[model samples]
Target: MTPLSHIRNFSIVAHIDHGKSTLADRLIQSTNTVAERDMKEQLLDSMDIERERGITIKANTVRIDYTAKDGQAYVLNLIDTPGHVDFAYEVSRSMRAVEGSLLVVDSTQGVEAQTLANVYQAIDADHEIVPVFNKIDLPASDIDRVAEQVEDVIGIDASGAIAVSAKTGEGIVETLEAIVTELPAPKGDPDAPLKAMLVDSWYDPYLGVVVLVRIMDGVLRKGDQIKMMQTGARYGVDRIGVFRPQMQNIDALGPGEIGFITASIKQVRDTRVGDTITHEKKGTDTPLPGFKPAQPVVFCGLFPVDSAEFEDLRDAIDKLALNDASFSFEMETSAALGFGFRCGFLGLLHLEVIRDRIEREYDIELITTAPSVIYHVYLKDGTQMDLHNPADMPDPSTVDHIEEPRIKATILVPDEYLGDVLKLCQDRRGIQLDLTYAGSRAMVVYDLPLNEVVFDFYDRLKSVTKGYASFDYQLEGYREDNLVKMSVLVNEEPVDALSMMVHRDRAEMRGRAMCEKLKELIPRHMFKIPIQAAIGGKVIARETLSALRKDVTAKCYGGDATRKKKLLEKQKAGKKKMRQFGKVDIPQEAFISALKMDG
Candidate 1:
């Protein structure tokens, strides 16, 4: 077993596209952790979707052995975490498992909104952070300016910051040397009773559930009976291993070591993230303070395009849930869309990735409803309930008022695009909290409704700023708002899938946009269809989809005018009768398009 003083645990954190993964790859390659022949870009990102999207969806870990200038060998356990706001939960979880963080900043781009958010998380975790400036090979790289911004914005001293180009492998040796000298070693007592923190777990088809753990107090070995303190379940360890970036079996994991263990667990839930693992008989008396469970912020419904694939979708979701603990779902049905599941996600990106995975991995086409945030609905009788779907809203007469979830958003943009960014926020009913200058870029903070931002706010922000703006936000709790559910009707029949909640002041405008979009999307039938958007019983917006017409006079060549007139009259009568009994068949494509309102 390795001594505790020889082990150093740290995580690499930065903004999206700021080279966190590249830096990790360089470190792994420099230490010869993986053979050079097997080297690949983003080696830590094991999923295809992650590589295609150029994002890290899950935090991945690896262990490397490096001999420093002191001529002493050391063990470094590195956790590479996602940089996007949607995966902030993954970053925080990784933070708790390490004692220090390597803050990577893009020298070409001084500072971003996500950079501040992640750096603060490290600070909150009481991590010893070492600043590293990346992309120094680029002509636009400005190391001094970024260091100043880091000091001014994040309040971290950057005087001794290391500058490197992760793309070209510069400054990698210095980076490893700094990790050994600057960062403190993890402290743990190998003789103490077993106390390990379950940092993450996922389902492995061949091996069942594999858990990644950080040994805090004692030794964990193969074939030993262990207990999860939080869930109070016992199991015998089947295998013990460590990631050389490739799984290598090991005999035992001592204190301050990070490794993987298989306990013949049937499900991932049986080994919850952040749970304390201890020996079944002589375990520690006090359990570690595990983090709170992840709370899904956005909600939506996902249904298979082919109703026959509902069972397939269920199987896919079950398999996905075994790997992703943050994603949640429940069975739900819609009048127009048929059977589906109501799913919850951390953010819009999380929802899209899951939908895409189900479609691609499971080979099932899907239709997704409008994404919404949870609401607090209070009744006149002093009772409150949580509202996940607008279609399931309670009667307005019984409800006293509705409180909508709001968010505190931070946006960093160049000075030239600041006006457009502010206007976009104002149009979304945002209240400006503060605005300041960080060098040439403007940082603006706003208190905005979460539902408004959920739709097309991010897209609008990117378009208006020409993709130069970086944004991040967190839930700011709920506030009372004059919100009401807007229902869309086709041929005077309500479509529950398109129903959504909007503020009373902007309901009419939003309703008009929904009606106009639906009119263009829904195909014309034999009868005229009246499309309306209504709040309760009052219609706020209306659009008429004209019926498909046929030439009735074609069959009456050289006949009396009265014959043509009679034919037209008969056709009008038939249309009227058909309108009353007609069942509108909304094609699957239309349902998907209508929900993607570009306005």
Candidate 2:
């Protein structure tokens, strides 16, 4: 039997930019998980996109050998999880592999909404939580206040909160010691029927599907036949290996150990995270609990400006979804924009990550439409269908009744912005649910439709309150309401390019604002362009912008052939970058700014 003193399993959780990754870096360095000279910065965040975004999207597991002050070596399995709500499912799944978590709190930004959300998730999983106040080195930090908030919210006495600077490597040794003392060792019956959970999986061009799992009940070995509880798919385990944190692999991982497994599985879908894998004949179960994907709360369509990257875009989504099961897409075509996809996401950030990955990672240029949330439309017979796609909506005249998705929104702001914040919420059809004060901060809650809150609300809240407002929303059930679908028309033809749903009461204001923003965004090309907002058959607002009348009209000369070639090459590149909307060639930055809708 292996000794309990040799094992340790834990995760680090915190809000975005709360120094979770930086602290993980310090822990890895102190533990000597990677070599002193050969260590890469943010080593756990090995993905290029993760490093660029400064967020941990995927949960990473690393095995490090740390020597306690008692002079005993321990095997510590450190798991790093994503902090964004978009990857909440991924975070919870990663948490299941560990016995405890380091709840890193920012001293300056005391107890954020996301921090509370994750702490509750940890509590639900029954994992031991250790609070740590990070960024003690920062000038604005108030460690005492943050620790009090943590203790109050978590229902744990955080008087022992470790104050550490992951940047300067101060007080890290004590934090390491706390993990060894405060967190309990993983306890499981290894002699029972073999059972394990698939926590993470990745696809390699040469190795096929590489799965990471935590053995919960029994010992697993090579040549063992395994069945997945979620899919009922069976496979013969080819090999078992324990993590060395880097590339080196070892044989035979035991219970409480974090490691990888290889099987006859070829596709990423076959090896899903949070699915139960058991000894084939010894254990049989169907539909594993805790594996259900979180339903997408927002939907949007994406199309290529060039109309040729349609296949490329589809392939990119497929490749990305291999690692990211949360992002979903379906084929769609518009008369205005040839072929596209209607993609579903958990929230706005989820949509942004997928869109950014497609363009920046896969090298595909895309034109994305405004986002739409699911709307519940009830039939006369009481049958209800959730409408995620705008095309799925029945004609307004044929519809019996329409109900839009609502969210319970909570905003934290300075005391001065309380009045303005209420006015902003009222304008967006928000019903004031509650209002309270904690010290000098104002906390306001509103029940607003998801569709109403998805667009420009974040920016508006920040602008009206001088950037002191922070907001978060949890989806509430749909409510019956009066709303209108607004569309933008170019010339006389309906443009699928510009479409949104607004409440009937505020349709005129929204439509006019959108058209005015579009007029400023659409560039001048070879002909004049007209931007018009229409509701059904009537045009509600119109704006006109002249198109580009002239560009380069110079000819190349043989005497200055190199310079002429350079100029022509530059023009071609410029033309390729500009997207042709009607007769106007709009730059990519214009589309980004239009999405923000902030002049």
Number of the top lDDT candidate: 1
Model 1 lDDT tens row, 1-599: 88878889999999999999999999999999999999999999998899999999999999999999999999999999999999999999899999999999999987899999999999999999999999999999998899999999999999989999999999999999999999999998989999999999999999999999999999999999999998999999999999999889999999989999998999987888889999999899998889988899999999988999999999999999999999999999998888999999999999989988999999999999999999999999999999999999999999999999999999999999999999889988899999999988999999999998988889989999999999999988999999999999999999999999999999999899989988888889999999999999999999999999988778788858999999999999999999999988888777777776565
Task: Pull out the clashing pairs in model 1.
Answer: none
Clash totals for all candidate models: 0, 4
- For model 1, state the Cα shift of residue 68 in Å: 0.8
- The list of candidate 1 runs beyond 4 A from truth reads none
lDDT of 2 by residue, 1-599 (tens): 24555688999998778888888889888887777886666778877778988888888888777889999877788888888866788778877788899999888877766676778778877888889988888999998787776666556788888999989999899989999888988876777777788888888777678899887767788788888887889888877776555655665567788888888687787776788888778784443365566678789988887788888888888898787666678899988668999888888878888888889888988888778887877776667787776655666666678888888987877789899999989978889988876556777889988876777787788789997777767777878898777777764556665676778877787777877887877666545567788777788888877645343536644576677667767766665454243344456555555556542
User: Model 1 Cα displacement at 575 (Å)?
Assistant: 1.3
TM-score, cand. 1 vs. native = 0.98
**In model 1, how large is the Cα lDDT of residue 225?**
96
